[model samples]
Target: MLDDIDFKDYKKKDDIHGTVLYPAVMVAPVQKKILKDIISKNKIVSIFDPFHGSGTALYEAFEISPEIHLVGCDINPLANLITRVKLQGVSQFIFRDIKKIEDYIKKPDGIYEYSFPNIKKWFRPDITDSLALLRTAIMDITSDRNRLYFWYILLDVIRFNSNTRSSTYKLHIKENDKIESMQNTVIDMFLSAAKMNVNKFKHKSDNFILYKNDIFDIIKHFRKNTFDISITSPPYGENATTVPYGQFSMLSLYTIPEYDLELEGWELDNYSIIDNRSMGGSEKSISLTDFELSLIKDYLSLISIRKQKKVIRYFKDYFYFLRELCRVTKKYVVLTLGNRTVDRIEINLVEITKKFLEKNGYKNISSVMRNIPRKRTPRVTSNVYQKPVNSMNYEYVLIYEKNNVTPDREFS
Candidate 1:
């Protein structure tokens, strides 16, 4: 039935979906429909997205049923900020906050407020000055919720004005000519984004909590069966070779104040810190079972011996999350997976995740493979991991129902 629900023309009937540019996001309309179906079956449905990329699923869950509790977390600070601001909703003082920014942008009396290593490499001097002024304006807003909304809108503006190539998630520099021609007056772009998104969050919803911590850190505090459903699109591959969400978010992260991001003081230590800390960022290998290794064995055979360790460890780390996920959700786990090639081979993460979930007491009740008709990535389809290509075709949406069997917690 999910396959029958065509998301090809989900024109974002509301303008909220595109306020920020995250590397990978769930299809808003499709996610809403999925939540609606689940909510229809159950009287009260609480939702959680461990990865919470862009907070798309959580926002959709909030929209479909405003009163239901929605919980989400991500290791990416930018993601947590976006999710928090989104679920925080537009404050009553939104207009006052916009006016505050408008007034500050006119004079920009605040001094340059940010500095990170090689800031000049990604942002020009004038662009940094301009961004610093805008960042000051966002920080000056009276309310944290409104301030967060402006910060959420500022992300794309930073990406747009940065010297980094907007084409890729990596921090590759743009051509000199392109850099020279970049926008110096970034306030116009920021203001435009603010206006587009200003009125969308008119109904303030406070029924959500967001965390900017590792999945385990958040899950350890949650009791068993804390959520009715968990919907998320976990990272397809290691951040270095995959979507690089941390890299994609770095420009904006650097521009915002550390206090606003609720930093633990070392998240911005280097350009790759967040990526290096992501799911498969670790180079260390974990012990995998013969049964677990058997799942990806065929793909590992053709992949280089050195690359095999990275692939093996990524899944093992992912399994750790799935095991905890199975413990928390009471009813269903909804996952949206893509066909990004892991090491030049189109990896079937959906099938692999299905097996992993089954090992944790869930049965794949519904599986839907649909064409990704529109993507903000390089093309209208999903990305070709590591190496960009033009042949990506389908994204699998899987729904797993909790079964009576309790999985053995033998693989710690």
Candidate 2:
């Protein structure tokens, strides 16, 4: 454990990464501070994030060092789009121009013709119509990147306007309540988000890239030892059942016709070149290997409930997915993860990661434990999985180093 290692003082503005409130996917500001502390130790040449949820880590990596190259990979096209917008497309002029565009195109009456039954089920007609109009306006932009940036902020408003108790990241909504004016809420959120992004990246230079593909496939294209740092947070086991990431952002990711609908279940394929499995809801047909099957069976036995089978399958997919990640990383691999329960059994995620490193010729050098003060939910308490919020539980930052470099066995 790196418990004794102390962080030196740094101004919050200098140490912090970009902030994300809508959809609520980025790591907390204090957590980023801890991560930045560790990141400052190395002069990283390049960095990679496999999951890239909301591009939180990549943004922080840039905040730590503007010169380091960054690459982010995610199966979620919406996440990729947002990552690109924050990194490459965002600028002050763009936001100002978008405001002018919105004002010029006054709300057209009877624009409520198109309908999504699912959207209407949750939102009032006026809200849905306003959203549709915003969607149309963003699509009309000439530059693909500029259009995507516009869409990212617009989508951020979707959940903000909802009466749902939680943010969009978790699908569970506060029930039986209606907001008085959905259209107004959506518009306010869109403008606020646009302004935030514009101010945040007003001085950014172009050195980051976003890949809308499975982690495995994206890493396959990189030569061995290509990156100096691999800092990421993989999915938190099957606990993801609480929220459906794809369904939440599908409205925005599909704004363009060029993006394939097939990417929805991307984790299922053996795109051997990419080294990842699909985590999409439509991936019932994908198969697993004997080793992975064993882990899945153990996961099922631990949880011992039929309701969690889908999540267990997704967990299995993520486990194998990490192995592929390790294959591509060069010197340091940093994983920020937490434990969770399935059925009723607890999964020690950090321990699992350590075991993986040991198996792949890596040695655990240090780990930092940080208190998650704002974790609103009760610590999970079951024999299978003990909640970190439980006086005994907390999040961990584990760092490992490659023990040996086998040049002869280098992967092509």
Candidate 3:
């Protein structure tokens, strides 16, 4: 029984934040506020985020309630690195000393290297060599935690020092551009980030953990009825191919812990990866059925013949993922998601999620819609934004509760 508060009134004015590597993230501050309001009612002993992009939700949860044990799980290794660095406080000594090591590497005959094929393409020869040296120096240190901290700093500076202009989230290197000085820039930024992170714990106690594992698998490892609350903003249906997560984040991943593991393909063969249209024309649509109709209408109007199959794939994958999400949660589940329009077809995820939750023995206790104000950025083509109408800006905090959970429920 979530009330329809004025969407325009709750509009968030802050900048939309993406992760260091994953650029497709649409984090509106208003949705975060709504989530905080929902979480305030419960004493969340174990707060979990399956799609913990940028670690904003976990960080906010930690900042608000220090006693809450934050556990974040993500498929991307770079995301895990970001979460780990943000949660685990770094000592000042480690931060200060790392600068010396970084400076030494700038000298001739620097030590270390990652001769991975992919790594070679992105970085200049000297830049790659220098980074390899830095990587070795950090790894040579005995403390695993300190090494992780150093790794995060080094990764954070990759995009800034490269020839790429932040075009979308992926590295689109500018042609005929000089290689930016990687040495001083990378080292200085790392030191600054270290200082900022350490300063956070000077007042409050540090207690948070990040797991570098997929959410679907991580749930199997957890005891039943373990988490008190789950909060996350998962990918939209059509985002897999349209908004490629791995491609955007490959550079960042390489800079952090180089994963030797196989990357799970969520496309083609997998029915779990879903894509769909966004919500555009149906600003007035209310019911789930109406939303679907609106999305289909928009789909017919906007996309080319080539993308027709993908639109269907997006919705199917999304629905299945929702069922899995319902299976894992213990009590409270808060999803921050939005309507995505693919080729003008509006995808109303809230309705789809509500049905899925009800089918999975949960009740849609409440929801708060937050309007995120949009800024008209320079589009690649002038004709793209020639129309007065543009992308709608709003997301939701849908709160579902597991009313059927028993006290004697077994964890197996």
Candidate 4:
């Protein structure tokens, strides 16, 4: 383990990741530092991130190790697209592609290109019309790679124009008066953003592979010991409770052409489908009450039985994922975790993860705490009482090394 250190020394602004917005992006320089250290200690060939939100870790790894194989996945199609575009890099003729966007807008279809429940509530009519026009133009792009970069830029445009308040991650609409006053600047926003974002991802590399499936499902196709290292920042808590990544992304997912995304088992009929499929969100997964951790028992004892169920369900899913993640990874695992609030109490995820990894024949090597720098997530407000509070003040990056022995029971 390295000596106690401050992340402030290694800090550098993200050039590529900032081109598009994503919730809870791992710090790029720190991720690079971790990957660089791992590569120096061992001969690194490939890296994996199951929860590759916006591809922060993979992007940094790519910057350092251009030849290293990169693999990552996220349930959100928008995330998949963002990371894919980042790894593939934008074409050199990105400006020419922007000029071509005008060609696709032959004539307005006079109707929205897609539909979902209460779509009108989230988007003003004029805004919808302009977006549809832009969507058509993006679709007209002949090359899939160029089309993807345009789509990546459009995600921010869609979110900003939507009636949903950009101040928070949850899908709460702005006041009616505010919505009515909004302008139809979709075309302008898309054009300016496309030009601005095109240059951020111009370093082309094709060795990386990104998946858009649940981590467990994606692991099934992989043989044991496939990746040399795994670097990921899993969600701090259940999606509904913390950041509703699915709900926050609903507008973009629905707006982007389904054919382009090539999504699997994603039903747009309900907005909460992605969040519900998230960890601890499924009904069947929630009913598993046999969590065999003393840390869990001690923590649950302090909270009400009602809230205990939530904690139990989330960890059941988390522990299951941890086992599978360790099984597939060969040498090292670096997890950046956060302790989030549950019923006004902090859940010690850092300690919990250390203990859990130990059960799977692993030992902690490095643990460092870093204050979140320029975080986009606002001071979290409770939906129940409309109260805002400081949250997720810091994050812990825990590094673990796998022991040689394979077989051990997971719990006491």
Candidate 5:
């Protein structure tokens, strides 16, 4: 039982160093024990994270047993880049190179020439020039892995120095005075983030195989039952309205050239494409009757017509993702998910997920609710259909074991 597990005392302050360097909804360090405990019980030899945001779950797996093989995939280039660096680990030599590169970046005489549609809106002219200098220096690094690490640092620099409101994941600008008064230089923020990461870096021997493709596409590369355990916290509800991960990351994605390869001639004008391609972004209509879960039906009835479609779309994509997750896992699956609200209606995602897993031939082992002491999500109430609704304060840690019987539906 979770009551017997002392999560409070197990807290490690330094564990967050590498994971929190770049922002997304991250799995807390203390909560990692839930996954670690499951891995220990199953005698797991391999681990996989389909939505490998910052590689927290896989990182915990490596921390538990460094010899375990790790596989992860995310559609976001920045996410892939950050996770790759965290798993690969850094060396003192890389820090030395970063220091040298830092010294080499001198302020340009004129505005650093770069064009993104909202460049002037998000950042000050001087700040943009400083960021361009850092970008150039980081690009000069010879090693792909090391360059990625520095790019992650630059991501932090961009986020901190920008005019974007820090309180929420969705992009919104602060007041002009507030933006103008901010004084942190790009070089200082980059060096600070890099130094902290370098000091905390721990060398590991795990085999990390990461893919920059969508989860739906990457699942095909693995044969059935390739992974012993699958652990992840997938995006909850509609990503466009709820999280806006792509918008939060747009500044960094636009500034960093390495991201351009995956983006394929991405311009600021097509920024909506990122959110549009996210999990719930598919517009294909799903019948409300298609979902067997009662909670989904109840919520669908309460939400507005537009919101009902959004909910249906999110669940449809999630169902397909879950099917693929079951396909690749041999034994255990651990999921950490938050129940969010839409149109003043609380969506019990955890309960719905449990029902879905049971229908798909997995037996529920345990489900525990844990308080989120710290997270990237805003604490304020969100406006849904012009009605104010509070965000999720707690999350569910659900564990399930794959049954030997075949599922009712084919994953393919």
Candidate 6:
């Protein structure tokens, strides 16, 4: 570990390459600083992120402490793939393989042959053919790491080459005129992205361990007190109508054959599966009285009956997630949450999270409200009770330290 180096002095070297990897609400740089500050207070030997998202938290952690054992879990395969690539570090073998793929792109052997449902709707015919060719070439690579690296490149290609508008999370195709003006080809985009990533990832490490499974399923595998620090930003609002993470990633996820939803027990096939399985995605009901945040109850009463259930269900999942986090985290957990609106009523998620954590044997150290810089999420305008409502502009970072007096319980 670079104990002599000042972690606070370090700054991001490549923001563009980092943000383009995946589209989820990223933990802001300031929030990362808050997490690092908390980590600095303790002897941090291991780090965990239950919702890895684009793996930015772990990436920052590794940058601060290269030898720290890092573990992350995310339900999205694309997230898992991106996290693994980021943590595993780029190798010379992968770079050489990327070079070979680049050379082959100059003189392709056969016509593109891959197809999937709704594929043409998202991609122009020519663009589809080029992407298929790129996919085949990437697959031909012998190394798994190299294949994943190229696959990551393809993800960027799909997003740029697709007919979908860049601003919206939902998969809405651009107007015909906009589509006609788009001149970038899949191969060109893929090669450019690959080159940029290769240049950025010249240095590699092997300290990270990632899992492509649900947080609940994967948390069971970890023993008690396995992590020194945990930092993450869980999904906010109703997954279906709010932030459709799975839907946003459909174009990229469809390209990976292992994500076939038709396969038994394949949950990823459903486009909204990630959001549907997210914090508030379930249909089960919970008593409003069970929650300590009266503001949540007030918001529930203000929103439509249907949305009320979603709010309650989300907290239910949120509560369970906190319990698991409390069980595994040995010292501290940093949670960054946004205060979204339900029927124009501000739901202070940080306050609710604070209550939940304190109840689960965690001592709340502090809650810092931070302005969201460069918010990537498009402003959501939804009809609640036939009136328009918008999400909040700021988020809060809640720092919680595990109460040493309380013993860790086995997560059921």
- List the lowest-lDDT window of 10 residues for candidate 2: 267-276
* Model 1 ranges with Cα > 4 A deviation: 108-110, 283-286, 376-392, 404-412
The window of 10 residues in a row where model 5 has the poorest summed lDDT is 260-269
Per-candidate total of colliding backbone pairs: 0, 13, 17, 0, 0, 0
Q: Model 4 scores what on Cα lDDT? A: 0.79
- Please give the CA lDDT of all the candidate structures: 0.79, 0.58, 0.56, 0.79, 0.73, 0.72
How well is each residue in 237-333 modelled by candidate 5, as lDDT tens digits?
Answer: 7677777766777888888884433543442345666677778887654343455545377888888998888888888778778877888899878
TM-score of each: 0.91, 0.74, 0.71, 0.90, 0.88, 0.87
The order of the candidates by TM-score, greatest first, is: 1, 4, 5, 6, 2, 3
In model 2, the runs with Cα more than 4 Å from the true position are 1-43, 107-114, 143-145, 167-177, 180-183, 239-243, 254-316, 376-393, 404-412
Worst 10 residues of 6 by lDDT: 1-10
Number of the candidate with higher TM-score, 1 or 5: 1
lDDT of 1 by residue, 54-124 (tens): 88998888888888998888999999888787777778878877888899888777565688788989889
Clashing pairs in 5: none
- The best candidate by TM-score is 1
Candidate 1: Cα lDDT at 139:
76
For candidate 2, give the lDDT of residue 211: 75
Per residue, candidate 6 scores C-alpha lDDT tens digits across 347-410 of 8787778877887788876666655544456555677668777665666767787887332432
> Taking the tens digit of each residue's C-alpha lDDT, what string does model 2 give over 170-227?
4445555345533356666776666665666555647887777766456667776777
TM-score, model 6 to reference: 0.87
